[model samples]
Target chain A: METSSPRPRAERARQVADVLRQRITAGAFDDGPLPDEHTLGTQLGATRNAVREALGLLRAEGLVERRQGVGTLVVHPKYGHGLDRLVGLAEALDGYGDVVNEVRSVGIVTPPPATAERLGLVPGAPAVHLERLRRLGGVPLSLDTTYLTADIGVPLLDHDLAGRDLFALIEETSGRRLGRADVVVHAVTAGPDTAALLDVAPGTAVFALDRLTHLDDGRPVDAETLHIRADRLTLRATLHRGPA
Target chain B: METSSPRPRAERARQVADVLRQRITAGAFDDGPLPDEHTLGTQLGATRNAVREALGLLRAEGLVERRQGVGTLVVHPKYGHGLDRLVGLAEALDGYGDVVNEVRSVGIVTPPPATAERLGLVPGAPAVHLERLRRLGGVPLSLDTTYLTADIGVPLLDHDLAGRDLFALIEETSGRRLGRADVVVHAVTAGPDTAALLDVAPGTAVFALDRLTHLDDGRPVDAETLHIRADRLTLRATLHRGPA
Candidate 1:
């Protein structure tokens, strides 16, 4: 007579679990009420203890669940969201009312290192700067900073910036209508400056969107960075399998 | 006597900026060397003082740059990476040699309410649980936890999990092939559990990818959450012009 080697308690449990895992994944065992411990043990030709141990292993893997009185059951599948689209946050909250943007500060200053390179500017050219704290119904959401060339709108800083739309103001004042833009998004935590501006807890998680707008001729003209709360915003993107 | 109202310093700069912005965005001013302050001021018939103030505003907005002793320049547009794709990190690093995955534990348990709903799992069922820390070149890159249906893989715990591909193993063991998946990406600070597993500093900024995979038949198979180093990884995605 052939005999299988005696297995340790843990090993026995593992052996039984392997068999059960195969059956469930193979679709032989659909997601529904499972056989009782005795029947499963007898069917697999293993002890009830071994069957129980195997079931324990499955539970931890987020695969199965066991109710107090009810038998074990199976779970269906799920889907997740994408992050590539250049959608606007304002658009994301289109239905939500009471959206208000609080103007933090609006002034002119020099460009930072990365910003200067992106804007195709001289190391020392004059530019117009605007900063604001965006809020929805008094709840702070994001901190935005925008830059424009001085030659384009020399008197831009004197506008009623707190109430006016920037792109519209640029069109009216400079005669340069708003066009398309390119954007970059990244995961980031709130730095001291952003934390203070957004009034969030220090070291909280945040999402950052960096964008550069261009004219119809494709010349880069403006740059803006929007820093926002991560939890409050849900970034979604959909991709097509076909050609770009 | 015809007299024009004297413009404030801020207002004068803004006006100068509007003309320059219009010209630049219209491509009349390519992202190239600018005319000298005296020349530009004379051509615009504006005082150099007002021009300089306007330039200052643009610099702060990151639209233009003032290199040390160099002239102003325009910046290039930046691109953003989205988290909505259903790509696997292990697959992302396939160019590297064999990776070592240390299986921390496996057990049966119930998922949190949110996770349960996301996975489409019943309130009570057997969930297979697995925790692993992923490493690259001996350095920890991510820590992940996955949950699946126990009934799909009864003897799952005893499988040769170490160094085994979960997807491959599932196909071979359960005959369930994955067709598509949905995912969510977010920025977060390392918590205690994540810090300990990935060996990262607590409160360090990290990107989190939460995902759910489905079979070709549209059955949800597994749900996973991955915590990765934010600075070390750059997420990328491509988008076309138009709605999905």
Candidate 2:
């Protein structure tokens, strides 16, 4: 579709975004507010239009906090969940130790057909279900609902989760070591019920992650569906490229 | 974020959602409307209340689209771009060749400072800028704004892009083979200008991708920022895991 080129405004914004991103990362304005539009434009020899555009990009990247009356302030560090390893919510939210886990429920129930098939169970088989809410500094961060087949889940239900480490509990009860896991990350709007739990409006975009873990012998041990607040969390990963 | 454990209604909804998802994916109602609430409840042995809750989940996933009076119909196939490769938009949308390219503008301009730095150019150096709109079946699909430095970008300016393949033109004109690219994918809301361009309402969620491509010898060749409608496309990737 060949038509007229885009307006120069966007190009200018890209330039601003690039420069500001570096300055922020290099700690030029460490823990400080960004200069006003006039000052910043003068300092960078960029038009105020460009600087404003750049700030929008930075805010979209979750790099700065912009308030109407308050100046543009650098937001405090946020949690970064790495995609390379199998990390739990507690481990992912490490820098912020002011975290708590509230186990909402635990019981045995008929497994969903798809999940039952994944766990190599009969269609009507019962599975152990666990629902837990993870909070950071008393604010909801994520809600995790996990399904485990009875062989391992039954033992897990009998164990106390005062510590809230489901993996450890599963390993101890099932006597199986987690070998590897497959994680699928995608986005979904919060349903009414999820919105109430996560303290967000219904239809707000959220990170929906599904994880399937396996035992050393290649047995599926556990499956978890985790819904995380997108605003408070950013998942990071490096996609390596090699010669074709 | 301690609050009520969420209503039992949520739990019931999830159970319904889970069962219905399997049915849909299994082609139980392929290309057809889902059974009405009463019919569905009777078939799955679930309460009508739960069936209604489940439909909401399906609607959000774009699996089954709802109409005011007609009925809920299954959506057609969707595109899934893999993150593992550096695929041009034209190549990614090859299955639908009816897509037209509208080049917004083409010219030499002052390189945005940060982009200049990344491209190894001195500050204020001129770069080639190309803005384009991509439409599929006469419907706007994405907006692409690309930045190319002069040394390589100049020669390609004279080449014809009637085929809508800029990468090929660049390769032929610059005499350089494409190597690898690093792409970052994230979500952002469509601001006023962007919304108008893509024909979407303001604040609609869109997928933003930033790609930096390099030459065979590791020289940066092009940098592009592409905005795509999320509801129209989903990026798929298989994340492999091993011990760190």
CA displacement after TM-score superposition, residue B83 of candidate 2 (Å)? 2.5
Using DockQ, give the best candidate's number.
2
Query: lDDT of each model, Cα atoms only?
Result: 0.57, 0.67
TM-score of each candidate structure, all chains considered together: 0.55, 0.77
What class would a CAPRI assessor give candidate 2's docking? acceptable
lDDT of 1 at B159: 84
Cα lDDT over the full model 1: 0.57
For each prediction in turn, the share of the native Cα contacts (below 8 Å between chains A and B) that it retains comes to: 0.18, 0.14
Residue-by-residue lDDT tens digits, candidate 2, A121-217 = 7888888877887888777888887888888888776566545567767777777666667665555566788778888767665666666777767
Candidate 2 per-residue C-alpha lDDT over B1-244 given as tens digits, one digit per residue, 9 for 90 to 100: 2223457777668656655654554457765677788888766557888878788786775557787776776663345555555666676778756667777777887755656776777888888877777877766777777778787888877776434677767777877777777665545555556667888665555666666777777888687777776655555444443442
Error of 1 at B201 (Å): 2.7
Error of 1 at A242 (Å): 8.1
Model 2: lDDT of residue A155: 78
